[model samples]
Target: MSANHRPREGRPAIFVTGAASGIGRACAELFARRGWFVGVYDVDTDGAQAIAATLGKDNAVAGAIDVSDADAWQRALAEFWVHSGERLDVLFNNAGILAPGSFEAVPLARHEAMLAVNVKGIINGCHCAFHYLQRSPGSRVINMASATAIYGQPELVTYSATKFAVRGFTEGLDLEWSKFGIRVSDIWPSFVKTRMAASFAQIASARALGIRLDPEDVAAAVWACAVAKPRFHKTHWTVGLQASLLAFATRIAPSALSRQVVRYLAR
Candidate 1:
């Protein structure tokens, strides 16, 4: 959300990165309905504010932030606190990037950018939001993951690698942050409807390969994770049953699934 707007006063706060679109926007809207003051952060300040306004000024604040930049995270938090006069109770590390290209064909610049935004971005938000989250007795962190992280999609290997990193980062944190009384959950969404899939050609390609999740369903799970109590859940919230099935098969039959994924996606 844009920084110029005033945050609605007198409500508990939630800080969500990538609130400009898709699941982030959906989560922001839903969280507001749940009565939390939402601190919306997105690189697209205008887009973020637009969504925040829809949720009513009484429940949201929009701010510009490139979650990968440490200083940008700092500035967004400072702005959020100044506007709301409250520390964040829930933080969503949801900003990420996906650029489709073959393993060898993927551009280095986009690969780096995806890694920075998808993996490092989550890490940065966790770092910057630590103080605020710790202040709340019930604070929790929700990190976004992808079904691509479960196994390699040959054509989108670079994006998958970054998602793999997200899975690892979230898992590692769930272990490390448990003692601090913070819950960490990683959401592995298969194919959510969002602008990020522009490079994926068709949702059918994803469907034939496996499942595709809806943004609203995933957003609802994000809200559940925020309020639900669990020290750390290692299972990535595999949205769409096919996602969980593939995850299971990959675990029980790695060799066969690897060969099958290549053959299935080749269609």
Candidate 2:
């Protein structure tokens, strides 16, 4: 049976960053499938437009924004809120970059860029969308954290640190916004089979780990976080077995032991 598609007039709405591809695109599609209006925001306007088209004209809107820029985030959210009748039920800060090489091997410029997008981007999204979220009952913010955030990974040093920043930001804001009735949370997914993962496929140890998740799996978790009653109190949403296990291990194991486990996985 075909999924139930809601009419556009009275549906809830979500704004997703990095909606050009990968998990962001998947989340946009899924939200549209479930009858929510979607704002597909990405630096790649063409890619965002394509996804919006796929969701059908009535279901989606597209915008181009460099998340690293706070002003751009303001412009994007303003446009999105207008399209969504000034109602924003969710803000999925899913846009990020990963440099899957050794810290020293990756250039300084790339590390700076990663921090700008992966860390600053999320903060921009949260700040820009807070007013809209405060006005909308049950609204929430969902950031894209990573398994690497649990403990830093060697090859993905900068990227790992950025995810840690995201995790910390999500937790802090989740509490701060409680009085405003706006919830916040993040997803930690390990090795999703997206273009980003493909970029690192040549790494023997990553391949040896032999566990990969579909973008849709992470998308489903995003949806879960959005609609879960008691909302964002559960700030850590893990997307796969490995992600969940590692999250558990990090809590119980010593820091050295956890680092060893990550080293073993890399090997």
Per-model TM values vs. the true structure? 0.90, 0.94
Taking the tens digit of each residue's C-alpha lDDT, what string does model 1 give over 1-267? 344555555566788889989889888888888888898889998898888878776678888999889999999987887766566777888998887756567678988898899988988889988887787676778888888888877667777888888888888887788788777778887788787766566333464654366678888888767766564444368877767877888888867766687467656
In the range 40-135, model 2's lDDT, one tens digit per residue, is: 999999899888889887788888899999998888887777778778999999999987787778899999999999999988888888788988
TM-score of 1: 0.90
Model 1 misses residue 111 by how many Å? 0.8
Give the alpha-carbon lDDT of every model.
0.79, 0.87
Cα misplacement distance, residue 41 of candidate 2 (Å)? 0.7
**Model 1 residue pairs with clashes:** 1-62, 1-63
Angstrom error at residue 171, model 1: 1.2
Reference-based lDDT, residue 100, model 2: 76
